[model samples]
Target: MSLITCSKGHQNPEGSRFCTLCGEPLPEHNAFAGGINTGLVEGTRLRDRYMIKYQLGQGGFGRTYLAEDTGRFNELIVLKELMPTGQGTYALQKAEELFQREAAILHKLRHPQIPKFWELFRDRKGLFLVQDYIEGKTYQDLLNNRLDNGQSFSEVEIIELLQQLLPVLSYLHKQGVIHRDISPDNVIRKEQDGLPILIDFGGVKQTAIDVATQLAAEKYGGSGTRLGKSGYAPDEQLRLGSVAPHSDLYALGVTAIVLMTGKPPQELFDAHTMSWVWNRQLNLSSDFNKILQRMLAQRPSERFQSAEEILQQLPAVSTVPETRVQPHLTQRQITSSNNNFIPPSPAPINTSGQGHLLDNSVEVPDEIVGWNWGAFLLPGFWCLTNRVWIGLLSWLDLSVVTLGIPTITISILLGLKGNEWAWKSRKWKSVKAFKRHQRFWAIAAFILWALFLIIIIGVILFAIAIAGFGM
Candidate 1:
């Protein structure tokens, strides 16, 4: 086979479109040169080392290209260009300064969840920034795929995502960098480890804001443009042009809700009432629901003060209580509060051949009152064991709404009224019979609860494995 050397000087087999080591496309010797006059073309070598293969994306501030580092054996890298549109000489200078500042911030960040910054340079084309190219799909792509498949993220999945990503946010906050833009599009879930990587810092918008302020101080500015997603950005950030760490939290909260409901933030938010109406679409654990609500609060003061505070409020999956069977109570005469059932008094009954009266009375124990822990802890199993059809249906309904999160209130109510429902469901000949049946079912309920827990754990592990495999 014949050999061809790529622009990065990597020799490869003939007819290869891209370099094996660096992913740079090999230029065709007989290819025509006529193309769009953007100054950048296929196989264009920049800085005498980096080779641009193709453009990745473009925004208001700049264009991004997938390039290869010839110095590093054609290793893949991203080159971002600072091509400010319709800006004059003075504005362009400010933009360049902002770009440099962004580069400095990126250099200071040292987290596995963030992309590594390489170097900043300026050429005849424009200002350029070289950085590591992460291999993965954005969260927005993942969400869209799920929506296309007629499925959405479950509460547990969203919670796990938040748990995994919040620490990165906390790390950034401690370093004095507020990620002004934190929408789903900005978060990439790496294919190898299923870890999220935050990308696309708001450098361009920040630069614009700085320029606007500077010009305004000199009486040459009109109005500064806002720099965040409309639905995800809080009022303070969107209206007042003030951003804080908590601002990122608001966007994260909106992202979670969007993932959970498979609906846009605009649809979920009610501008008339100035509150989110997402609660009606999904059911979530009380703690999680409260945390998201506070995070999405209209006022930043009403939200969590820090990421650590939000972490503390997240639900712990390992704290699920082990099911315990309650002890059976033997025959005892009972008095009803709403009914006039007379309590049995002490009576003597005789024994032996002659008809005799012996003590047939037993002390009545204190009434079982208040909440029932068994029902509260294991609602589905508790209902199934007790054969409460209504309870089972209610639990199933709630599970569907909350994306399979068990309803604590329903569980608690079941625990409080479980015994009463059991007694009313069947006709018992004596108190001893009722006690025997109740004890048997209690043991059965515990067994069912154990099986339920095992199944849930297995499903979670399976999901994690699939996610790790990028399936």
Candidate 2:
């Protein structure tokens, strides 16, 4: 089961929905928000080069090993072994052909949602395909956990899931690459970003299966290793062994329904009737319902043609994360009662390295936000450096007429609102970089302020001495 860490460092299962020790309402667990489907090792070297750590799994193709690339400072990698035992002479030929064509293209595939394909090499033992190792639980794992607790994914979850995953398919299809296999097991909700990363591309699987199927037919006189999973894959791809862009769409639609109902494809699909019987099991919005239905349409031509079509039709901005309530009030909320005073930073949202941006919103990160000494000390000058141009309003002469009340008020306002405004106004390379820049200015401001105070005190002392001497 997947676990979530609470603020107090308590690890809680996702299903528990709260910190077992603290009883704090478990944070909204959206780890696999669009999870339709679906690592690490410190040890092991392969072919005297990659260090093998652990055996991930095994099947007709061969074994998968978690290995470390010593050359890359032991960066984690996944090694898929293709062992078509006793496939005779044609084994290497078939492997070479498939890997050269599919692996070549996949290696060139660069996308945030897909793992970086490393290399495909053969050895005395067998063939090995390498790729980056992603760390996380598959949607399937999460679904199983939920099922263990007598709950399935909700409608909202599926909707958000589609919002996240469809774009990945669209990119693949545009590149003329078909995932071939896209079950919950193939999609992983990355531990780092909480985004869905499509993994286990069908290319290697297909290559292994092709040779495996040949061996099966020649020896056992049988067929095996269908590229797409039963029920999850449409009839045509599984039966014909041919796939198109829509083939992936059909499989994805099946994966979605399975996630919602917490049931496998075998139970959800009616083979005898050649139709889906999942509607009675769960309630979904009509719009999303229609979208899934069209995606699952049995005929390739009948289904939505592309992932783009489905994405364009999915429920709108509902997938966008809801704005978090910061302790600070928005600009419009500022008031004269001092209740409008800017808030002190709230506890962090536990999003380190997540890089949540406030680009188009007022959301302030708890850690990198709060009173800005630089802005408060030198509002007019600091505004230019931080690119918060509007802050130059501190230069307004209204302070002169108000006996410095307005100037002091503006400075306080700058102190309170500076971080948020600067964050939104400028393009920062990173949160750390932004913090560093602000720290530098703050030190400068403090040094300048200290010098000014020292000078003022010295002048006052001299004036006092002069008055005493005159007396």
Candidate 3:
């Protein structure tokens, strides 16, 4: 393997698109792209550097993974493995060239708001494009939080978002970097500052879309419809790859209105007229509506050519926290969920007529509700292991003094109540964990009981042998 150093003095793999250390995009003219293979299980280490944590998801043409970089003091980064639809080596090579071309362009991009593309590497498994791991919940996550009162994004919040992200887009576009894909799913509301960080710059994605589209046309005699891209992408951009800065703006406008309306673009736009009817869904100030309308114009020439154009109209709007000026949307107040303490959900009760302990505060799952072998064999030791303190009562001298009748009764009680008593005594992660813990005790008890039986039999046999020898 060869290494290439960027202007920032960061050494990367020979064909890496950006410096892994500083995310510096090197000057163009150096191009390298490779194919990706799949099915690297969790914890799989690549090049003895990146340890795969787990898969993030499968995308339109690739898989994403959350990995730890051992070489960088275990920094978290995202590994994207591109899975081109084309099968032949030529097709794969073509896909790589296209991926590399877009990636090289994306390498020129650097912004705090956008996720940093680091380096590309190849291990035995496949090629991986490494990038910073953003820690935040995406807008989609916030939007889909329906059970949490189903709050929609308010006008003020949307305005704030535009203010924050429009500058980022301006930076990217100034360098001729257009994020072909902009959706609620791609924008993360960073947990640290609550500022949005843009992920999925659409370099590899655009490459895949190109390859997939080409393959579709070659095989099916016509270019196939892209199912997921339809809602966000404009007709010209989706049907053809003639994308500009306005294309991204169009998608952002759609995303903004979607967040406000809590509806997808497919629903908001009337296909019959081929124009937006989002205004009918919700009311907005004229200034905001006018801006959004210009951004979403059907013709690229009609839409705003630059992100700065959108930013100039939006002055710094003061936002109220936890305020709901609009009944339809809410800007969540800076308060913990505990402050509005809802009553704890009732515990699941055993409905099978099985008695419980601690007034049924703890659930006795049916799977563990049975006679306990460990309790029956060694009540004292089983009590220690299972936390069933009542099982120790079997050792009382009163039980032995009553012709062992009390002891027998206590053992039966221990066996019958073991599961319920243990369920109440301690906290368990799950029913499976409880069963596993009890199983170990059962095995240990059986082993000790067998050893005791063997010792008693040996002593009796030795006593008989001694008497016979004396006789």
How accurate locally, in lDDT, is each candidate?
0.67, 0.70, 0.71
Model 3 residue 433 CA deviation (Å) reads 40
Which prediction has the highest lDDT against the true structure?
A: 3
Cand. 3 TM to true fold: 0.58
User: Which ranges of candidate 1 are over 4 A from the true structure?
Assistant: 1-39, 86-88, 212-219, 318-471
Tell me the TM-score of each prediction against the true structure.
Answer: 0.59, 0.63, 0.58
Worst 10 residues of 2 by lDDT: 29-38
Candidates, ranked, lDDT:
3, 2, 1
Report the C-alpha lDDT of model 2 over 190-218, residue by residue, as the tens digit. Answer: 88766789987776667766765776687
After superposing candidate 2, which stretches have Cα over 4 Å from the reference?
A: 1-44, 213-225, 317-471
TM-score-based ranking: 2, 1, 3
Model 3 misplaced regions, further than 4 Å:
1-38, 146-148, 213-228, 315-471
Candidate number that wins on TM-score, 1 or 2: 2
* Residue-level error in angstroms, candidate 1, position 267: 0.3
Q: lDDT by residue for model 3 over 378-406, one digit each (tens)?
A: 78778886667776776784543578776
Taking all chains together, the TM-score of candidate 2 against the true structure is 0.63
Model 1: per-residue lDDT, tens digit, 86-127? 245665566577778877888998999988888988675357
